[model samples]
Target: MKVGILDSTLREGEQTPGVVFTMEQRVEIAKALSDLGVSMIEAGHPAVSPDIYEGIKRIVKLKREGEITSEILGHSRAVKRDVEIASELEVDRIAIFYGVSDIHLKAKTKTTREEALNVIADVVGYAKAHGVKVRFTAEDATRTDLNYLVRVAKTARDAGADRISIADTVGILYPTKTRELFSYLVREIPGVEFDIHAHNDLGMAVANALAAVEGGATIIHATVNGLGERVGIVALQSVAAALKYHFNVEVVRLDKLVSVSSLVEKYSGIPTPPNFPITGDYAFVHKAGVHVAGILSDPRTYEFMPPETFGRSRDYVIDKYTGKHALKDRFERLGVKLDDREMEQVLAKIKSSQGTRYFRDVDLLEIAEEVTGKVLKPRPPERIEAVVSVKCGSNVYTTSVTRRLSVIPGVKEVMEISGDYDIVVRVEARDSTELNNVIESIRSVKGVESTLTSLVLKKM
Candidate 1:
């Protein structure tokens, strides 16, 4: 399956209060993320700091040194300096963001629509001339007049935007509306690639992402753990999962998802809640007795997928909702079964009885035997590990998981995986003593935070 993941943690993730990454930290995170298998990395906005130039430079160096196959990109405004800085850094791609909606054009840029179009022509053309692949972002494009959005995107394409991103900057679009708008843009415009950058203000980021894709969007802009301005942008985990699990698209390495999210969390200091999609701690965990039972019998029964498909493991959370049917169902494959009458009897007992029922396979059989004349024989389950692949254009991802992973540096790589936690990495530390130096250096990457490193048996 193929889906691209953009790390805005440096740009947007840093926007979270009290979140700051030294140049070293930024480099560390970026390197780790590159190893994690995201197709693209939005390194950061060079316009934000004097050190940004140095940061981008270091990122390019790290990517090259680590043999990272991912693309390195920089963000800019639709202006000369923004494009100039990215060109200076030699980044492969540059995204120039501007407000095209009438409201932003008037309030933020204070330029008329014609003036804005002129700016687009001038700046975007310049960036292309400088030999940088361009992606022009019409900020808040969803709210802009359709005709105007077309005008701006066409102008950018004419100026040589390899692609144009239609942004729902305020997260106000519904899935159907998003599909309608993007489909119109797709049918109306044929050559240039369409991209979507949706926000999560209304908790519809994933829904909108899928809608845009259906409308012919080939690229998606997302942040780790959905970190960004206001409610955040599309989440790397959510989009990756949708593309992989729901649409059978391939642009991500599902096995590396957790490893990627953890790094973002540590660097950005914005934790993905337990329930966040895909990478969230509870995303694949079964807590209810019924769910747990289903998983125990056949993971696909309740999960439709195994956690390992996404670099995660399944977990069973004990709670007050346990039921004997659930208990029996879970261990049924282990030659455990309860007759229908016994099943109803157990339910009645539990409904009236107090205390928690912690069921194990043995306990289930014992209960079954007490009610039945014969003892049930134990049998090994007929377990199978199978994969179903689909062909979509040039990508193939299972429609079940958003697998993700990472390379390592203690304290840095572990934190930026986004959405949730997963430990998967191989760090290159020269020695135990220099691990601190490794830590400091690793922290410079964009999404790195914690390391999953152990002391070496012997330093080479």
Candidate 2:
């Protein structure tokens, strides 16, 4: 069976406290998910406000315009008013949900089991009658009594709901229990499509979703970056990669995963942890000496999934524990070829540093040059001095040009002079090549009409 993804980044994900997506950001995310081949995009609930209603309408228009291929769904409660608002938005599907557990019904909705079922039947029937698909959700399904959950499922099914969603609303379900619950539901509610919406409070959201799939669930609800209430739901990147790599189940475009995650993280204002799976900053980085050596030899030795699979490249971080192989690879990538002796010297320096800190590319190059007694690039001369006069089109450009010239690599100082020159600059270089390059850099600055350079033959 082909498992489909129901991305709720704009719906349940926006429910994350302190998280809000502008209307444009919502549309952009929907388009990106559609392009990524997601089966459905749950735009926010229309009943929330006119802004959300307009957002859903815009998504529907995108689908109609053929800009997006995925079906757009709007969320709603098991209330007639909610369903009516969703119908007005004209989404491809309407997700009608109601709290079925005893606690939620008592403390939240304050409705009896019978009354809740009646409400589900009415809303499901209303949504179906409006010529739109209906997905019924049993909010807090894992905590609800099995008998009551079955009755609620049967009520929605009989009332013409197209699909049923079992939400681990509080993330209380684990792998084994999730499998068992879905297995029972799939057996009892035969012929009805089932979706799983797992939360991540227990950090098992992805695992539980996979378990549900093994037990016959065909749809998995997830949010990009796992953005949602109190922790969040299953992360789209994690679950999609798990489904593809672990289960050999292809759901969405794997390569587009990282881009989607980045887009959501930027617009959502919720930064993803560096250790977050798949899309995290450190997810594909290797720092340990042994691991780096293994990865350098063959990436598959230490990595289960290649970074290229998600549009990311493996990063070999250099620190105190870096191996010779990793260092050699890094030097080659930087266009600095190091011989065996030179390589060992650089490695020794890194290991003996006062504090264990990673070296930047420039720092590493400098270290390599120092150890090899060779310069990768020409260095500025130590004692030579020169005066540069810069002419600018306007006084407005003089200060800016002086500021620019003051920061060039070989520039020692800059001053605005009242002579024929607009600005007088003093520079020093180790060799003619370095001085010439610095002069060229100064000439290249915008608003500089011309420059005259005079070298000091002898600096007594």
Candidate 3:
């Protein structure tokens, strides 16, 4: 299973509206993705200009801290100046591109088929002269004439281009078309690796990339949040996840998927779509009753993949839709059992309440104690005596409650804080310090959301 992941977010992702990354932002994202273990990172296209040139160098300098799976590379047109910048950066590879489509040739390059091949041969040779690997991409190959595509690709091969990328630019190629195009590249373009870079207008970028891979394309290009020009590029998270889960090929580490996506989203000012595959906030969030039920029963039953694999958790969202069994299971784990009817009542009470991180098993027990005065403890303390208060949610209606106390050393007397106590407590402790500990412990209790602790002003 040959696998490689190329992060194009810096080059393509920065093209999104309101998206800009400072040199520091690009360096940090590069280090983080390098730590994520991608085999290749497209640092940026140096042909963009000198400022972009310096940013790529910054990332290249940061790579010396330690070796990671990702090696930084730059994108460029098939030209001498672009290849020279890559040489200056000391990058690992250069994606020297040519707009192969007749449309682009007539409008942009204004060159004949023979002339285009010369440019491909000249620039790739220039890059090879500087000891840089070169990848030749037939820009808009999906729309280019097959004969010219073959001719230009052969030119790149003769010039020592290491890989050929068949770009499905504009997301125009569906699976069948993409697979056919890649199949042709594999058969016709001899002695070079082929890659597929797809866009997402029709939302088949990942499928197309995979189809190309199965058709003998070795590398898949992606961006963290699918951030790129227009409809965005193939998502790094989706393609990496698909390869791991579907093909049983382990290439990229899923754990850093969220971190990389998050940093790019932050720096690029593009919040990950809530429903984006894997990294979205709602990717593993469960709210529906059956979905939560299925998750609680067997997470794998309802989930396509485990959330924790991507540095996320399978979260059972609490809501009006949250089931009683979920809450009952929450209590049963704490050695407390409630009848279905009792849990029904408890769930109702919680549904009626708001603004909390869901109750823990212990909280359910406390609720049970408050409502029915049922002590859920399996072993009630012998000589057990403690103050009990009545609370409806948070409002304690009475000023006092009865308390019974006993001591292990068998103290003959119980002390009570009289009427002034707001609510009285009669308890036993080993000594004065122990007594203070008991008082402080209860003071920290939650239903008593606030506390005012004071030692007796003067001993009786």
How do all the candidates rank in terms of lDDT, highest first?
2, 3, 1
Question: In lDDT terms, how accurate is model 2?
Answer: 0.87
The top-ranked prediction according to TM-score is 2
Put down candidate 2 lDDT per residue, 85-204, tens digits, no spaces: 989878999999999999999999999999999988988998899999999999999999999999999999999887999999999999999999999999999759999999999999
Superpose all Cα atoms of candidate 2 onto the true structure and report the RMSD in Å to 1 decimal: 10.7
Error of 3 at 141 (Å): 0.9
C-alpha lDDT of all candidate models, in order: 0.71, 0.87, 0.74
Cα RMSDs, all models: 12.2, 10.7, 14.7
Comparing 1 and 3 on lDDT, the stronger one = 3
Question: What's each prediction's TM-score?
Answer: 0.72, 0.81, 0.74
Best by lDDT: 2
Backbone Cα, N, C clashes tallied per candidate: 61, 3, 0
Q: Which parts of model 1 have CA positions greater than 4 angstroms off?
A: 1-3, 325-460
Error of 2 at 215 (Å): 0.5
